[model samples]
Structure formats: structure tokens, C-alpha cells
Target: MMFGVNSKILDEIVCILSKDTNVESAYIFGSRARGDFKEYSDIDIAVFIEDPNKRNMIAVDINEINCIYKFDIVIIKESTSRELLDNIKKDGVKIYQRPF
Candidate 1:
């Protein structure tokens, strides 16, 4: 598995995001995504959704999942910074994107 983290974690995360119709997409970035993560490395999850409040709610849902590492959730938006967006797009792994 990726970085020794539980695959169930990713499965549950995608399941949660897929349940939410508003979520346009989701990605896993940062050290974990790059396969250079240490034991203390946290999982960086970027969620693309319309409602900021709803996105926060989704983050809460994800946080409910128990794990050894922390989950750093970021909501992707039009107002997101170019640098971060570029990094995520360039290196991030897309986990889920709602069907059209």
C-alpha cells in the first residue's frame, strides 16, 4: 500500500466523497502522494466542491475516520492560489471525479 497507510482509509474517503453529489473531484497530494513520506507524514487531500460550508462538512466526515496519520483536507476552489493548484495538478493523484 502507499506509505504503509491503510488502503481502507482511501477506500472510505472515496466512498464518502462519492456519496456527496456536490463534490466535483478529489486528489491526494503532498509527501504521501509523492511516495517520499515518512512515518509522521500526513495525508493531504484536496477536495473540489462548490459549497465551502458543505466542503467543511465533508472534511468533518473524513476526519471521523480513525487512522495513524492525520488527514489534511483542502477545498479546491476558483479562488485557490495558482501555486498550490499547480502543485496539486502536477503531482497529485486523482482519487475521484463524479461522472458527467
Candidate 2:
């Protein structure tokens, strides 16, 4: 039910993303999270991880999982600007968090 995205598909996405050990958390933001998406709107996701080097690879892996929807992956690192992190925290909807 996330911005017209199928719940089953979202579940599958979560399952796939969870396989990445470096992913500390994931959030949905932008139009999809706000519920104002158009038919062509891309899915926006932000992933928080400790290792910045793994960002690109993680994005590639997620993109390879499915092609039914367009995805924009934003990788958040420990060194990310506080302002940007705060903005994301305020506007994003947390979709997944790895178990401690």
C-alpha cells in the first residue's frame, strides 16, 4: 500500500535488501512516501550504512532485483551532513531496519 506499490512486491524488496549485511536501515521518501506519486514517479529509497564504499554496489544489487519500478537509491553514511540526515529523518518513512 506504499504509494500504490504492491505489498507483496514491497515485502520481496525488503527481503532482498535485508540480505545486505551493511545496511543498517532503509527508508522511503519523496513523492512515494508523501502519497502524491504519478504513474511514472520513481521510487525513492535511502539506505543507511556504515561503509560508504558499499553504497554503489548495494544500489546496483537492489536495482538488479526487479525492473517493474524505477528506483532511486540514496546511501547515507556516518559522515553524511547532519542537515541532510535530519531532513531525511523528518520526511522519510522507515521501511526496514536490520536486527541488532
Candidate 3:
């Protein structure tokens, strides 16, 4: 229930993401975060990681997980477009972050 009470898939997604030490933080955006999801809607996730090169590793890890929902993982970085980053930051729901 990271994004909201209706998002059960998010809990499972977080478990997979949390195991990766490179992952700094994560957010959920798009229809799922807005609470207007259909049965087949993919969960859009934006992640800030320690190394951008680790993006592929993260994708493989997430894809291997047996989950009912599809996850679209986006890597957020300084080089990423300002407009797209702003939009996600504005609407995305914070779902995970590494503990200090």
C-alpha cells in the first residue's frame, strides 16, 4: 500500500527493490499512482540509483520476480530531461528509499 491502500502490487515491488543496495529511492507515477488503474495497467516506477549503469541489473532483477502486474522502471538522473523529471516529481508517489 505504498502509493495508496489499493496498491497491493507495490508492496511486493518494494520488497524486490529494497534488496538492491544501489537503489537510492523509488517513486510510483502514472495511472497507478493516481488511483485510476484498470486490470491490465502497468505500474510506472521511477528510481534514483547510485549508478546509472546499474539500471540493467535492476531491470533484470525486477523482471525475474513473479508478480501479477507489469512494472515500467525508469531511471532518474541529472541528464534526464528536466520536463519529464519535473512531471514525475510533481505527480509521483514516494514508495521506497534506502534507510540512513
Over the stretch 19-96, how does candidate 3's per-residue lDDT look in tens digits?
Answer: 889889988888877878777788788889988865446666776667667778888877889887886878888889
Across 1-100, the per-residue lDDT of candidate 1 in tens digits comes to: 8645788988999999999988989999988888989988888999998676552578889988987778989998778899999989888999899999
* Estimated TM-score for each candidate: 0.89, 0.82, 0.80
Clash pairs (backbone) in predicted model 2 = none
* Candidate 1 vs candidate 2, TM-score winner: 1
What candidate 3 gets wrong by more than 4 Å, as runs, is: 1-8
Candidate 2 residues lying further than 4 Å off, grouped into runs, are: 54-56, 78-83
Indicate whether candidate 2 or candidate 3 has the larger TM-score: 2
Among the numbered candidates, top TM-score falls to 1
| For every candidate, C-alpha RMSD to the true structure in Å | 1.6, 2.1, 2.5
Q: How far off is residue 28 in model 2, in Å?
A: 0.4
Candidate 1 lowest-lDDT run of ten: 50-59
Best by lDDT: 1
Writing each residue's lDDT as its tens digit, candidate 2 over 1-100 gives 6767878867866886788888888998888887889887888888888677753476787787664788888888777788877767777888999998
